[model samples]
Target: MASPQQYLNNPNVRKLLDVIASAEGVRHGYNTIFGNERFSNLSAHPNVRKSFRQTDGKTNFTTAAGRYQFLKGTWDGLSRQYNLKDFSPQSQDIGAIGLIMQKGALGDVLKGNYQAAIQKLGGTWASLPSSPYAQPKRSQAEINKLLGGSAQQGGYQPQYLSAKDEVRLFGKSQPQTIRQKYLSAEDEAKLFPQQQPPATRYLSAEDEVRLFQQSNQNTQQSSYLTPEQEAKLFPGG
Candidate 1:
């Protein structure tokens, strides 16, 4: 049998392990952000720094709390190095959702009726809808429509165009540039809200080709099939 060090040294396996470790670290960090007592305490522990590094075949952290602290410190250090800031309420809520989803804890928490856990870990209790899964809140226009009012009455315009509009504006073959610009603008607006005006334009060569391929595939598949064939393929009439 291969030794643990030998297994870790294999290039392909090592890469896969690295990816898994990174994902695990992120999940742990997010969970810690929620209501994980061990992780929360460990993050603030002074001994955590000394324990994380293995030296001269000597391991650190004999206690569970010590190990947890070491892991939290390692994760927090990595987060700082990578500039990952989940300090905001919205960001923390999203982080908790991601952790819950990754760990398969959503159903368990919901079933247990751990309301305090849910509220503390997931942020505002009012944000939770009837559904167990987290969903995007309705846009102002959608809310207005639901209330039987026009979008203008809600004081917000739908600046984002539909996928169809995107394909029309930038031909299917060329979409990357426009898409990048749009994403950059959006990020800038998010980071510096006062600096960026609302932008509606989005044209990208890569996106165009992608969208076109999907649309074209749908069109081609539909064209040759009879209604009966389509019904058979899709199941529902």
Candidate 2:
């Protein structure tokens, strides 16, 4: 008979274990981060359930068992939300590993093993667990094929944007622009009705120069204007 550790080493079992662990970790993390005054305030509110439903599509779970169920449900929901399929088992496993890693790292950090925690929870942390599902190689073509070719036809090219790229895009793209890009025409029309267009106030070259001068004067008068704001007022041509 295999030892407990040996049993954990089994690919399939490990995957399942990891998924559970990760789900638990996420719950713990959320509770920890938002558990105190904020959570209490929200929980005590009469409209808390409705608010939670709006944000998470479900109210906060009351009991421990209910919370556990909610966590599992959330994991599944996220998978669907991201259109992350075919690797359900793997995704679950990774999530579990992440939780375990997070817990271990936290414990280590609390114990002042900051470096160790950082090392273990670093960028390659997900690959640390010995599971067959860890880091499953996927190709865009394969994903497109899996998505029934509609993904390709719809210009849904899958590219892993980095955190910085995501931030940059978020800063650059307005809500309207993003919605227009991602939402179907029918959906957009339903969600956003064409209101009377905002009155267009065209600025001539003189108006632009006058506005710049006023902005510059304001910046010079007020010490509150940041360097970036000043730079924006007089941008490089």
Candidate 3:
């Protein structure tokens, strides 16, 4: 079945995540907090409240932490919605995928439609192209490079699910009861969060289309809160 962690194994998805990390300046530090705020726990969201100056030249108190630079409100909403268990690297990746799904970018992302995906995602990540925030953001060319480049031969390949996998997920005959689209703690546990996940072969675009349709049928469409909403919810976020 199409699960959160499965998306992380996708070449395009992984590259997109790398783009986010690079843009957020967390390429080497998934544990790093926003604006040099400090923390130690991986068991849960490190709700580290501190004021930090952004490039905008004004200090905003924030809980923006981890590889994706999630603010507390954003993280909370994602965690609860996706059943993300902690602030661990695995959980963070899953949470990021959750954000992608939330922003309606997963279909475009699966198809390596970078511009469209980035457009949908920009609001949630200010450092991405098309962001509403006035912060410094990456150019399309820069994002292309991070995604292994569009013209680079044999650099990245699209992922597709096998026929058997497709049948199991969508059913061969009568439609099986639609299952939960998000992962459970038990499901997440099967992933072995401590270890680096193996390279993932992914679902076909057709399968992805169906999976996306199935997911929309099952999950609530909760948009990421706006910058103003975040600031109000988290005070300095």
lDDT top scorer: 3
Give the poorly placed runs of model 2, Cα more than 4 Å off: 1-83, 105-237
| lDDT, candidate 2, 180-218, per-residue tens | 235445544554556434433444566456555646454
- Report lDDT (Cα) of residue 179, candidate 2: 33
TM-score against truth, every candidate: 0.18, 0.17, 0.58
Residue pairs with clashing backbones, model 2: 18-96, 19-92, 22-95, 22-96
lDDT at 57 for candidate 2?
52
Q: Rank order by lDDT, top first?
A: 3, 2, 1
**Could you tell me how far off, in angstroms, the CA of residue 65 lies in candidate 3 after the best superposition?**
0.4
lDDT of 2: 0.36
Off by over 4 Å in 3: 36-38, 54-57, 151-237
Q: lDDT scores for all predictions?
A: 0.35, 0.36, 0.73
Error of 2 at 55 (Å): 26
Off by over 4 Å in 1: 1-96, 113-237
Q: What are the per-model C-alpha RMSD values against the true structure?
A: 24.8, 24.8, 29.0
What is the per-residue lDDT of model 3 for residues 113-177, given as tens digits with 9 covering 90 to 100? 87788888989998887887757788878877777766233356544445554555546884565
Greater TM-score among 2 and 3 belongs to 3
Best by TM-score: 3
